[model samples]
Target: MAAGMLAGQVALVTGTGGGLGQAIALALANAGARAAITEMPDRLPLAEQTAAQMRAAGGEALALPLDVTDLTTIQAAVDGAAEAFGGRIDVLVNNAGINVRQPAFDVTEDAWDSVLAVNLKGLFFTAQRVGRRMRDQRPAGGCIINVASIMGLIGYRDRAAYCASKGGVVNLSRALAFEWAAHDIRVNALCPTFVRTPLTAPLLDDPVAGGDILRRTPLGRLATPEDVAAAALYLASPGARMVTGQALTVDGGWLAV
Candidate 1:
């Protein structure tokens, strides 16, 4: 077998049943990391599909159903990745989140709570659980990449819930990095602009909002799932060993102008 930067490492990527999550998982495996995917049962098919693809590519892949909001389930899934691969879980990519795009005034308490539960609370707990385990392991370290959004750095109409959640992800990555540095774990965030994924597919069909997104982006286009995947790959690999607590933007200059 040929050697790569991530040779012999195991990676667990959440929400990878499809879209950006699957892309990240596939790319990580391609780079030599045995990959694992976590998603809710009956919610996503991409997790199994992505794992199968990785296996065919000659990479070890594990697919486990999970709910990031459920601490117990997530914890077990994290440990399972290590056990299944017969090695330590060297990377965790928190790619699960919900984007709510309703008018701020119309955003109900239920909407707020639902989004926060999954997007914020779920994200934090997953990191904490997986990070602690990694801290205690033989290698004594790992990488955590939280998927944020450009909305975290800026604002948009009808995206109050999304903005808040992603903003939380961005800052939480930094806070985790500070606390986990002593444990040899690196924490970082990826803030991508509106990417073409199932979550964003509806927006692309929306005549007004979709057009507006393209106009505002200096790249004059939306980012693809592959773009975010590349960013996740770099941060998870040894190439980003020195990088931590950064909300690396991959929005095609959406924030630049």
Candidate 2:
């Protein structure tokens, strides 16, 4: 693999306390980018641990606290990252999101709002802030990767809120890509099927839900964090210079059926 694909670049990835977010951050760092690993204040230690691992592997990394629900801190986080890395962030990975697994009717107003707030609203504002930074910076060219899900493309039984939020993310990526193309900023979405992460462990452990997921995926397997990380690396690298306003599905052929 080409380790220098992202050499000298700076990347900020949110929700990096564990799972896919941490995997993406580590992948970026391994690809020779200075990675900023961030998460909620309470999860800052996890981010730091990931950063430490990156550093141990001879990569540059920074750990920061970020809560996507708080709009006021978005700018600060982005600005701080840029300042820490010579005034530019080449990649923005909007990976901080949440889900509420409830049937449409059973979902309370609070559940709906919370899911949308982090998954949709937070993602938009974070990209907006980062897009502005990319636009204003000299030699402007940047990438934005939104971590959506296959649920956005299709539907699930008890994931009404999650499905709605992710579906919005899919379209939002397109809108941002269209509007930001002139600035040389590429915005894309990554849609992955069920992965065996802490976040999805509960769902994947259930006999019915897990069986359904496996049945739908032609490959009869779940995605690994590395699977999603590889796709993210491609989208962020120059190899995908022409790719934007697209959702790269990392499912194990779950959408094929």
Tell me, by TM-score, which candidate is best: 2
Q: Which RMSD values do the candidates have, in order?
A: 1.7, 0.8
- Tens digits of per-residue lDDT for model 2, 1-257: 49988999999999999999999998999999999878899989999999999999998899988888898788778888999999998999999988778887799999999999999999999999889999999998799999999989999998899999999999999999999999999999999988888888898889998998898889889999999999999999888999999999999887877
lDDT per residue for candidate 1 within 2-92, as digits (tens), equals: 2476888888899988788888888888889988898897764768888888888788888998897777888788878878987588899
Q: Among these predicted structures, which one has the highest lDDT?
A: 2
Where is model 2 poorest over a 10-residue stretch in terms of lDDT? Answer: 96-105
Q: How accurate is candidate 2 locally (lDDT)?
A: 0.92
TM-score per model over all chains: 0.96, 0.98
User: For every model in order, what is the number of clashing pairs?
Assistant: 2, 0
